[model samples]
Target: MFISPPFIFEIDLYREVLLFGDGGQSGKVGLWRVWVRFYFCSSGVSIFYVGREFWDERVQVCWEGGGTPLERGILRLASLFYALGLEARKETYRLGLKEASRLPAPVVSVGNITLGGTGKTPMVAWLAEGFRDRGLKVAIVSRGYGRKDEGRTLVVSRGRGPLVSPRQGGDEPLMLAKKLSGVMVVVAARRVEGARLAVEELGAELVLLDDGFQHWALNRDLDLVLVSGEEGLGNGRLFPAGPLREPLRALKRAHFLVVTKRENPSLRRLLASEAPQAEIFEAPMEGEKLWSPLGGELLPLGKLKGAKVGAFAGIADPCSFFALLEGYGAEVVEKVTFPDHHFYRRGDLEVLRGLIPRVDLVVTTEKDWVRLEGLDLGFSPWVLKVVIRPSPRLLDRVLERLGMEV
Candidate 1:
């Protein structure tokens, strides 16, 4: 029956579509990041291009079962590359220490061990605020995954609202800007340069590394790792096989670990064994979808419980968005998963109108909603904003770090 794996995404699909060319592919950077971050295996020494969106679906799907000889050949090649990419990720992490030693800043990395969609933006916001509240000037440095232009170090500041738009500053930096105002949020492809900009120009006393668990460069002080509750580590493979960026043994680099969702004692024990010196904590995403830029209105999350929702998200874990919606008691009638950091074009907005049915409400992640601002989403969509509710011990640990009374 070819029942697909439950948790991990099917990389073979991506590989087949991406590597083969029909000479009609759109060379957009948005798609490129998606490939490099998750897929794209190394050819023992170099990496291969497996970008699909440009390929025909019928030809691409043929590799799954029924396809001509040529189509099947492409599919087999993709599978080989898919397996090779997993090996490459492990190789990269293995050699990271030498490369990471080059950056001078004492980086305090706040990242998740897994790939894609952890509550990193909020946690970075929390750490930035905590440091700010403690009277220490803080700066945030990120890779700026989906900004309009590349190689620019953007400083996120408030003028109208919280974020500076995903097109302008990427989703994470924009979210950080909105959540922690008066704090510096800098985005640059070069992590070291971003760190320097935050330290020198922004007058930042402490540097917070966003999604830097594997970014060995710009170094770190105390590694704060976030692990999601649902499917904690996935199939626990390196890449195509699973979701881990590095091996479980890599947890030793972390001084403090925060598990998102529940306080799983068993997982904590597992992590403790891996990282004996580190302290484990817990947190869950908890925030009301009260504020929406579409309308200057604050609505309670409870009000939308029985509402039929047309949900859309451009996140690593789109299912998480749906699960959260169902958990909140809202009936998700339809869901549209866009590529992560998906820069919405005029055509996309038109397409979404068809995919999602008219419902009592429209729900979106804060990150997804931020990107939609530049586009004329005339229909004021209700945003389901989430916050990280720290475990009791976790809260205490943060408070202690900031010298604040809990």
Candidate 2:
């Protein structure tokens, strides 16, 4: 019997039959022999056995790209322990086994379920402005993540202005301080103590807790959980394995949920099923205008409409930033992305400096701008300031919950 090229052959040992050719020209060639030799004239051939199920499964896991089998197994195990610990801690508080410290002033918390950015800081700033517009003295209490000073509570802003630098206040806290002029921004590891300080020393009428969803220690009047529209509950697993800081069931604890960037129907549907009691709002993360970091002059968004731009962002979602620039009609010629909450060193600046001269302007997020205080990137990088626009109904609901007139 003669077999053609570009074909697949299979043998059934017990059945004593030879299978040849693929679906293209499939037919049996000959009877099975003890030591059969395959002859193929085609350039390439893929011969896969139907058996070896266990090996196939292992290969599939490897293709998924977590890490080596041992590493992935260890990470999954760690994620399991983390989930268990979180549940236990939440139960202790829920059953009154642990007490949460309440501040004299009403508290509002803005946070996310994931480790990456979900526009939490911008939402917090928007809320602060809303409260300030209503003549309320707002104080923002943050964990001051990535700050050099540890343990000690520092006042990033004292109503009049910022008293500390970004290195001392963390990038997010410092950005909040700069954005909100009258709002007092306080940084502490223990937000409960920070809230107390805000009320006692800062004379805060209300406190906005930055990244406070999982804190569990500070009592809050309202909890607003922000979810990213682009990356919704990535992989739907807990930390080490996925992006979730807590289980999906934790959404039930939030008074309000804001879907940032845009309306995510899938996420909305998931929240509706998981947290039926919670109200959901869609908030668009709008880029307002480009500003100079040196003098803080607002440049028209039109300035970049037809300009050749080089973009760099040390944000969790740098692709989103790039997309935003393109949406504004800016031609993004080059882009550089860094890890979320990445601290930029002098060496990093040198790398960016090489890419700056090729474009007309350099654009970065306001958060990234805070980290480049002293560094000279050979050119001025325009900072893109963003504002979160939540529904007016959501603001009214927040005010009502705070015992303030809408």
Candidate 3:
């Protein structure tokens, strides 16, 4: 083995930000980040290395508290690591650009620069379903991120597959497979190979690349980018410095823009400036209360007038969950936020377990529940799950751009 550049050290950093409150402060924890960023600029260096895999966690740590005092000191050494990350990203982008240059087959990517959960899954579903609804054969291509399969081309999932594992194709794509009725979901590391596979093997007319905003190698037809209006590009800095994968300048290539979680009117200018003339649209993540978590036993959220509930989630956007719960009439007594894709620990579960007996129900995101399965869910412990229902009008717009009508 040549070497793997200390990935665990950075992963722990990510775990700290998410599992703890380290990454929660956003703009508030910027005194040191500004200094680090300025230091890099003056030194004529870029702090992108450590690779994207490492940067994912690194970004969370820095985005949270300016990377602690020690991390701030390490910022002087960031460019060496940033260079590593950029090399990998640049290589991937090089391949993407090569693919884009030659292939006549148009690619439209649904992507974001941040780590996860900016509503790309729903957006992809909308694209495929809307296009299929309008009589077009749209297939999806994704990097398969965390999962492994065979060779370059893998049929990770299909709307027709009897049972698809989220663990197999990664949760989002598997979830995409579940929601979409006719689309083909392919997950492979080499997206160029995945795109080619979609066209040749699956008879896909159009390929929608999930999370390809920065995958510059593959050519694109129209780039439709989604960034939450609420979180409007956290801290406005690059990875290990902030939440951005690339600078805001990269958005000049976008054909359309979608600003989700616009429960407030304040984000309009931010959306427009991010993608001027990019046909910006705003929407919110919507859902209904069917049950508490026992599969059935219907209960519409509108009727929960005075239910006392303690909410919890280890999602990229827990505030959205809390707001949704409180919006639907659930009186939120307390909130507990865990890191995105957080594995439940005994210490943390005990905190939640103790609160279960006091609260009417313990609400959480579906992803969190998947991670929390059978953790001795405390006395009559209930979990409120959320389903994202896209706004119909914005859904129509997104579908239209992807060559579909909804």
Candidate 4:
């Protein structure tokens, strides 16, 4: 009896199989051996696929006290390298080996120490709007994550509306450009160049840095560090093993610590202990309204009750969006998530098309909607308009720190 090598391509991770044969015949035993080998090989490949797809989510699970021992071991090994690199970078700045460039106008930064979303974009928009309302010509400088041409400074908007597409300017910057009228938005890899252009070329009196906490290239007058109230510091470890981008001590450099989403007393107390010098504030990311981009009509959030929704988002911490929908009494029948800052493809829209019949309507975040614009999704999605409502005292403190009258 001769057994040929098996050609296996597809591996289903969720299913397991076992094969056996009668020991009486040689042909039957040979085939059984082949099947056994194939089964083991396919199972190995399936495990690899699962790891590749949910790598980030798995690490997050470990950070929040829920991962396998094998996963924890791998992440713990990788995190050592991450820690070494981070410390080296911090030492360079601390020893004055690398000096940050200064912009002409006052610069304020909104960033977080965690690896995922901490409501930084909404806070940036809030500060930009507040300053614009205060009679200051405002400009926003961003690193332009996921942009095509990040080597050079591009003016996303010059106070009116977006001048470039999301592909060229990045999704968040383009979203800010659309939401903020009479505010300039600029994107560059080197934020100093963008800030300089905003100050000299755009005639901006003040500059806001979007996701700029770790951006040590440009000196800022005030550092606003945001933390997610829902997921606070996840195991208090750095990078692969955990969610933190920097160590706990880095919070000491922050001028203000803002906890976003919901209230967390424990997180606030922990932050106060870690950064006693920094002022702590709470700014919940609340849904202001829902509006359709195609129809250009707004609907109150109360309208979400009794609605059947198919929600999809491509943002960090997309579960928060799903939870928000559930909190509003919306039945989220289908929940879809893509990678953070994902560019939607036609196939992705097909998934939504499949859900249309089962759901009353589709819902998505404003950030996702910016990227989804112009893509034919079979139907228009109602975008949730989220705003960060910081206390009035927080604004007053920010103004006082910037040496401006409130």
lDDT of each: 0.64, 0.75, 0.60, 0.79
Candidate 2 positional error at 189, Å: 0.5
lDDT of 2 by residue, 1-406 (tens): 2233543333223212111111011221222223222322222222211222123234335334655878667657877977676676667678998778888789999888876678888888888988898899999998786677645788889876678877888888888887788899998866778889999998999999888887777788999999988888877777656667788998999999888997799998987788888899999887899999887778888888889998989776778899989999999987776544556654455545545556888889989988887776566788998888888788789999777874
193-266 per-residue lDDT for model 1 (tens digits): 77887777766777787877766444566689999876587655543234565668778888788888656777
Q: Which number leads on lDDT?
A: 4
Q: Assess candidate 1 and give its lDDT.
A: 0.64
Model 1 residue-pair collision total: 9
> TM-score per candidate, in order?
0.74, 0.80, 0.70, 0.85
Highest-TM-score candidate = 4
Per-residue CA lDDT of model 3 for 63-92, tens digit only, reads 666567777556535534553554555564
Q: Which residue pairs overlap in candidate 4's backbone? A: none
- 2 or 4, which is superior by TM-score? 4
After the best TM-score superposition of candidate 2, give how far the Cα of residue 385 lies from its true spot, in angstroms.
1.6
Residue 73 C-alpha lDDT in model 4: 86
Worst 10 residues of 2 by lDDT: 15-24
Off by over 4 Å in 2: 1-72, 94-97, 295-298
Identify the runs in model 1 with alpha carbons over 4 angstroms from their true place: 1-106, 158-165, 355-357, 392-406
- How many clashes show up per model? 9, 0, 11, 0
